[model samples]
Target: MREVAAAAGVSRQTVSRVLNDHPSIRPDTRERVLAAMAELNFRPNRAARMLTTARSRTIGVLAASASSLFGPASSLDAVENAAREAGYFVTVAHVSGPEVAAVEAALDHLMAQAVEGIVVIAPQQRVQDAMAAVSLQVPSVTLHGAGLAGDDGVFVDQVEGARLATRHLLATGHRRIAHLCGPGDWSETRARRDGFLEEIAAGGEDVTGIVSREGDWTAESGAAIGAELLADPELTAIFSSNDQMALGVLHAAREAGRRVPEDLAVVGFDDIPEAAYFAPPLTTVKQDFAELGRRCVARLVERIEGVGAVGGGGGAGSATGSATDSAAAPVPPQLVVRASA
Candidate 1:
């Protein structure tokens, strides 16, 4: 504060007013302070400033796992940016594990700061179940939609994404298709598996020899399981639960003297940035995670500010800006066709 004030040739109080965006500060003076701040690369601590404000305007995020994972990590970045754009500060609390005690501890940490709202971005069932066991005072929402099924939840339609992948394989005439599933603990794993099964049954495909294998959402797990599933010569295609596993399956196919889209067709989920540059490229389901984040924040804000649901109520989230005024509905995923399938 002192450095910025000195650089801007203003008192510390004036600097404070600029930081707070007080209307009393003239535009030229505000510009001077901002330029000074830019030169000094100074950032005000919003949490510290919250003490003097009527509302802290902070949103808390309770993550059950490390933010390095693809799905939750991407959503976390999106949530932070969207929250900032909505004029709210974001505070994140990461749980060491999916225990009720951990969840309670994380909530307590956030509540200590008096966050106006909370977001749970981890997609694991254990995490959501643990969260459900605890009571919260502030408005809250989840991106996974695992435990919360109502209007308060926002998520990419995992089931529909799975159906898109499976339907593509089936329509391409891959009759003996196998499914590589993610670990059982995550809600997405179950939803995707259910979608694949639903499609197979709907297509009236014979379940006599079809198999579903579980992987740990890793390329190594995918490769090992892919090799095992491919051992059955009759299996002509594999729909992986995620892209990493699908990449692993590609390796397994190569080792088995099989070529993608020839000996076997492969489809994965998430359509990660690298999917398009894969060996044969990848046909996969693309989740609008950024849109999911925007919708989650919008839903939580609605509850916090009592603004009612976006687009009436219970509508699925769509891609847009100014999400607070848009629908907080479930974002749909699209199928990206590539050479893999």
Candidate 2:
């Protein structure tokens, strides 16, 4: 700002007024400031500006996956876009494990950065608890979290989404359906499994207990579990909790000489980009993970600005969830039908 003002032959306040688009600045002065800006390639420090206004303008993001995964990656992208639109920057931290220690480590890292707000996305119980234990000195929200309720944070409707996926298969005349569920500890996996079971019971299906296989939400795990599902003669359809596992199911079925939608139908969740390019394409449940990210950031911003209620900056005694509930809208889930099913 100093350099721009000097170059433009104006006071620093004049440059500030020009940047803020103040109506009082003359056209020539505005042009000169712009010209100085161009010459210096000067970009204002948004964080520093926000600090002057008593706002950090920086949001900290914590997720379980360091590498790319469909849900986490999409959510991260959504958060980035939304934050940029809202004039904020983001710092990301990854918790590589489902344990409390991993989550605590991630939380400590985020807090150390002095971020104005935080978003902790951990789908496992231990991780959720670890995050929950974090005293809310900074505004924070949790994504896909479980074992800790109360809309105090933001989250996706995992159970409802799984119900939609399961109901879709049943609606398509698949009675002997199987589920290849992800790791049992993950709240997402548990919610989806519960939803699938609930739907089956409601529909009066036999709810073949033996038809389900446990997977690790990975292709290899899916393929391994898929083999067991294939070995069962009565199985006619399968729903894998995630696209990776669904890919395994596809590979296993192909190796076993079964044609999708002919010998057996398959559906997966997350609807990853690659899902559409699979052997016969995968019919799956799609979660707006990006929307999840946006919502989380928005909530954090609201809390940081004191414009809305969230995390009362105390222990778990405060009721931040109730105040924010009206401000929060749950993101919906959808089904994408393709050749696989």
Residue 131 C-alpha lDDT in model 2 = 66
State candidate 1's TM-score.
0.82
Q: Which portions of model 1 show Cα errors greater than 4 Å?
A: 1-48, 146-152, 205-209, 307-326
Which lDDT tens digits does candidate 2 get at residues 1-341? Answer: 99999999999999989866689999998999999999999998876776665556678888875456677677778888888877777888898776667777877787777677777666666776676655656666666642235535566677777788888878887778887888776777877888788888876645553336578778999999999889988898898989999999999999999998899999899888898999899998888877777777776676676632442464323335445546665677788999998
Best by lDDT: 1
What lDDT does the true structure give each of the candidates?
Answer: 0.82, 0.77
**RMSD in Å for candidate 2, one decimal?**
3.9
For every model shown, the clashing-pair count is 5, 0
lDDT of 1 by residue, 125-168 (tens): 78877877887777677777532344246777888888888898
- The TM-score values for the models, in the order shown, are 0.82, 0.84
